[model samples]
Target chain A: MRAAIPTLFILVLMILAVSLLGVFGSPLLLRVVIGAMINLVVVIGLSIFIGNSGVLSFGHASFAAIGAYSAAWFTLPITMKKIFLPSLPAFVLSTQVGLAGGAAIGAVTAAITAAVIGVVIVRLSGIAASIATLAWLAIVHSVFSNAEALTKGTSSLVGLPIETNLFVATSAALLALVVAFVFRFSRYGLMLQASREDEAAALASGIPVRQLRLFAFVVSAAVVAIAGVLKGHFLGILAVGQFYLEFTFLSLAMLVLGGMRSLSGAVVGTFAVAAIGEILRILSSGFEIFGVEVIAMPGLREIGLAIMMLLILLVRPMGITNGRELTLPWKRKAANELPITNDQIG
Target chain B: MNFALQTAIDALSVGSIYALSALGIGLLFGIMRLINFAQSEFVTIGIYILMLSAGVWFPLAALAAICVVVVLALVVERMAFRPIRTADPATLLVTSFAVSYLLQYSLVLIFGARPIGLDILPELARPIVMGSVRVPRIDIATIGATIVLLSAFALFLRKTRIGIEMRAAAVDFRMARLLGIRANRVIAVAFAMSGLLAAVVAILFAARTGVAAPTIGLELALVGFVATVIGGMGSLVGAVFGGLAVGVVTVLLQAFLPPELRAYREAFVYIVVIAVLVLRPQGLFRGAAARERV
Candidate 1:
């Protein structure tokens, strides 16, 4: 409970900052903040599993897709759905729910799907588990892309209400952060972290590693699912392509660059990446540097971002936060988590 | 029956391309436990070279592509991978992902993201009919080239000194090092071999599609990665079989699934991959070196 103070403090600070930005910042800044918050929610959700379990998952975007599509089905006005998704099942076609209700349903749908897949996924560890998740991602992407009757195939699914303003997106991010922080400090989280450190040892010590992994996976999926819902509602449209490789790469890069092992790292990484990305976008459109008119080359934003990530990794392989939670400067520093020395490549 | 035969031929050809790509991925994983996602970029770079050299003599263009791909593979390893060689698999994978993005967008900067249409070997696209069975010439060439390459790869591993060192290193890196095997040489050789295979895949893939795009190699590389996992990580033979299995299943799915379901063909194949992982977590063809050190 005492540790919660700093965490809560940080959360409040983030919310205030976002609210101020929402009020005073330009419309474009608010839009970028909203987008960053969505990504922050995703990174936090992903950290719940990847940070605690010491596994890499490339499938969370699929869960996000599931959430977005589910939200679309429930939230889209009935008359509009009847025309756009003409072949939606009778029950779905007739259903129309508000944003919150639809988001709740989407989260449940994603969690249930994660539970089912987690049974198969949690059995493997290390690189094999990572690959399995990738396979899962491919499977989901293909299904969604081909399910024309339900998802309209590769085409856009519009008509979702744009209810995700800065406040809504920030609330979602706050929810995700609270969930991740609580999970990380809980007994289950401790046990999962133990397993992440040494699976064989954890098993020997009577930890139910696989079951804990499943729980984390489901929880993470549900959080990312909400992010998916927010993205759909915010944009008023959804597409299967939106939740594929590019999104996956962007989110993962954020998680990794911030430090995958701590909730604070997840938050920090997302904001850092967003800021750098925005600045690069500005520079790409030509900016005066020291009174010199300089127009950056095309693709410079992507190239620069990639280079920054690589350079960061080269300097601090763990990440910017280096696997430790953030603490106020006046407070005593948190203990550094033991470095995982799994030298075997797998 | 002739139609069935034609379908079978198509499957083999597709399987051959995947096999080459998987072989490249498997070779690198065996030595370093690195899954080189940038191999996709290697394929892309090769295709771009081919596109640029379209009017040049065919053999020269082919040779130039192969050389550049091999050099690129080496440079990437030195610059991006070597710094993090001892990092965990997750870190290594992410690094490769970064390298992949870097290489891909570099191409986007050099040549716009749009696909360029150019037939490297237009003659190969023609179909030949034998006994009422028609087979595309590219298909025959793909299969033939795969067989020749695989045979050459096998002999190289068996007969060459560097090949023996690579095998030894894969078996036990620390032990092999103790026994005087040069880690740098083995790893470099593995990268060069991977590059060679990527070049072949690029040429064949471009010939089939008649388009050179930055994203063309993405799907192929993904299939290759899946095939490597299904084949059993670090196992050369497993990579080959995994590649073949994915290719055949994908083609079969496309042929038999209803028109409405055709687009989901790759999904079904990946489902099978997940099922394989669930049943046999060690992979279908387990590598010689036991992965679990504990």
Candidate 2:
């Protein structure tokens, strides 16, 4: 009964969002909504590892990149894809599968890469882990940038079918949210959090810390791959640089700004930041200040984002949602009766 | 042989700059256990300062640039870092990232998106011809400066009472406090020293490339970071050796690889870094137990 509230609310929200997209029918708004939804998947995926395992990963975007290129390579029209994969398998060449197949393949590829890299990376803890993950990001970036035959090098690969509509994106986000929530409540999540909070104690309690981290890392990579597939389709293009430092930073910012530990926080943070970013773009196009032409406001979005991040860090470091999910009144009533300890709250 | 020698010299020059940059990053991490993502911005800040003060005497401009970076570092420490020193390391990491983005975009706001070339001293920028091979004078200067700064830094850590205290604090802040070492003062000094190293690297990097962009620091920071990891995280001497090794490997890859595949140099270097890390997670050199001071 307690879990039913969130599921109902999510269903309503998803229906309402799709209805709005259908009613408005503006390509730009559709793109923005789809982009936000896709980002929700990635952010929630990151939450599994970063939020639960308490290890920061700077290389998640690399998995996203792998997912993106993989999908593009498999799905794009063979004639248009001649720039990258000239000699493709007839199966990949003749048949263009739906978004699900593309996304699934992307997830598998990213998961495999993460599994290989996580073996070494998950062994390190704290700042060392952070640095090692960054190294992984750099390594992946170099590979994508140089592998012209596969990624079309730095050039934008065009001609992806515009298959990622409101339905696909919303479905992916819902799936990601469900998965993330399930993980959050499971024993695996509890053990990962315990390890994060007190590694030695958790180890003393017989938890295989490395194995748990590796599990979270692989799962996160797979989920983020779905996000990457959606983003590629939404944009109708893929570039190596798009998946590099800039997107990595943006995704990290969203996770941090949204409460890292909560599924709802991931959703809210993605929409909020996406809206903020879009508004900044609009303002930079139209508004002016102190006789300065605002349309040419260089790096305005980044500056605004930085300021927002700084304010959030200073004022409410736990994030806007603080890991609390918004649910139906009945759930709230039930939750009120429970003597909630601080341990269960955050 | 000449090509190999030239590559070796070029590697040494680049390695020296990386070593300088990594020294700052390594020292900061050693003391606070906080990876300041904003350290790259300090390098960018120093370069911008140098560019702005180009009309002045070169040495004076350099000094002013270092001072500016030191002051900026102190401000960041006070405003961003000090408040969150007791928080989780993740919080500090995120805050440092915010600071980095803030600095990068602020520069973008002020300077626009164009890359600016620093007007380095002509003598420093000129190439020093030697037999069949020629190396830039800035390379020589970078090597010299790195050696002097590292030596001075080692001496500071060994001979000075404050240095001892800072080392002690780094080992364990609570224990250092129990022993009456001022942790705040030690951390501040680390920031200042980090700033100073950033300034030195900035000058050398700008002189070598003749261009300065806000984004350049991120790449240099990556190299420094890899080197720091390859060198034991807390060991200063290890950072130097790791920096040199990374530089040599990158140069050797470029020299040996076919022209068509030369662009893969960085990728190869990253692979090497990953392999080294997997083989020796603790790094090549682990420092002996040092008293915690900072």
The models' CA-based lDDT, in order, is 0.87, 0.78
lDDT of 1 by residue, B11-103 (tens): 999999999999999888878888788999999999999999999999999999999999999998888888878776666777888888888
- Scanning candidate 1 chain A in windows of ten residues, the lowest lDDT window is A331-340
Model 2 per-residue lDDT tens digits across residues A99-183 = 7789989999999999999998887876567768888888888888888777777888888887888888778878887777677
Query: Candidate 2 chain A vs. true chain A: TM-score?
Result: 0.87
- iRMSD, per candidate, in listed order: 2.2, 5.1
Residue pairs whose backbone atoms clash in candidate 2:
B166-B294, B167-B293, B168-B291, B168-B292, B168-B293, B169-B292, B169-B293, B169-B294, B170-B294
* CA RMSD, predictions in order: 2.0, 3.9
- Please give each candidate's TM-score: 0.96, 0.90
**Which regions of candidate 2 deviate over 4 angstroms?**
A1-28, A87-91, A288-296, A323-346, B258-260, B287-294
The weakest ten consecutive residues by lDDT in model 1 chain B span B85-94
Whole-structure CA lDDT of model 1: 0.87
Candidate DockQ values, in order, are 0.62, 0.44
